[model samples]
Target: MRRILYAIAGTLSLITGLIGVVLPVLPTTPFLLLSAWCFARSNKRLHAWLINHKYFGPAINDWEKHKGIKASNKKRAYVLIVLSFSISIYVVPLTWVKVLLLFMCIALLWNMKRIKTL
Candidate 1:
């Protein structure tokens, strides 16, 4: 049952990671990290695959080793957050919700910026 749950979580994390690749509003690293954690628990094969993955592996390894994002990735994340927040402010119906989201976005951006990225 624990393995099954971990597998399910890994699957969901992978899906979310894919979505993050296409949709700038969502984040890739967190999902990939979650996938790695789940894979580590559930399947050695999957854990190896994730750590060996071409696009994601380097970032994951960097994060695991140094708790840092690449500079390019950090810039991209900032841009995405700005664009997504602007879109959400215009599209969302509730002003309060938009403000809350804006606050959250700023907080996340600030946190990301504080992290030492290479």
Candidate 2:
């Protein structure tokens, strides 16, 4: 059951990583890392596959080696961040929801700032 659970978690993490490609606040690297870890625990083949993936491999390697996000990635993330927050703030009707999204926007910015910009 432990292996099954790990596989499930790995799948979910990978899905989140995919979503993070379009969602600014949801970081791709962290989810990819979690997926890698879960795959390592559950499936050797999957782990190796992730380690060698074309688009994701570089980010994972950079993270492991230098512990930083790429500047190009950061620029993209900032643009997504702004658009996501702006759209949410515009469409959401509830004041509380707007405020929550505002906080989330700030937190995302803070997180990016805390990371080393490669």
On TM-score, the leading prediction is: 1
- TM agreement with the true structure for every prediction: 0.85, 0.81
Whole-structure CA lDDT of model 2:
0.88
Instruction: Evaluate all candidate structures by whole-model CA lDDT and list the values in order.
Output: 0.89, 0.88
- The true-versus-predicted C-alpha distance at residue 116 of model 1, in Å, is 2.8
After superposition, which runs of candidate 2 have C-alpha atoms over 4 Å from their true positions?
Answer: 1-4, 19-27
In model 1, how large is the Cα lDDT of residue 66? Answer: 88
Error of 1 at 73 (Å): 1.0
Name model 1 segments beyond 4 Å from true: none
Candidate 2 residue 87 C-alpha distance from true site, Å: 0.5
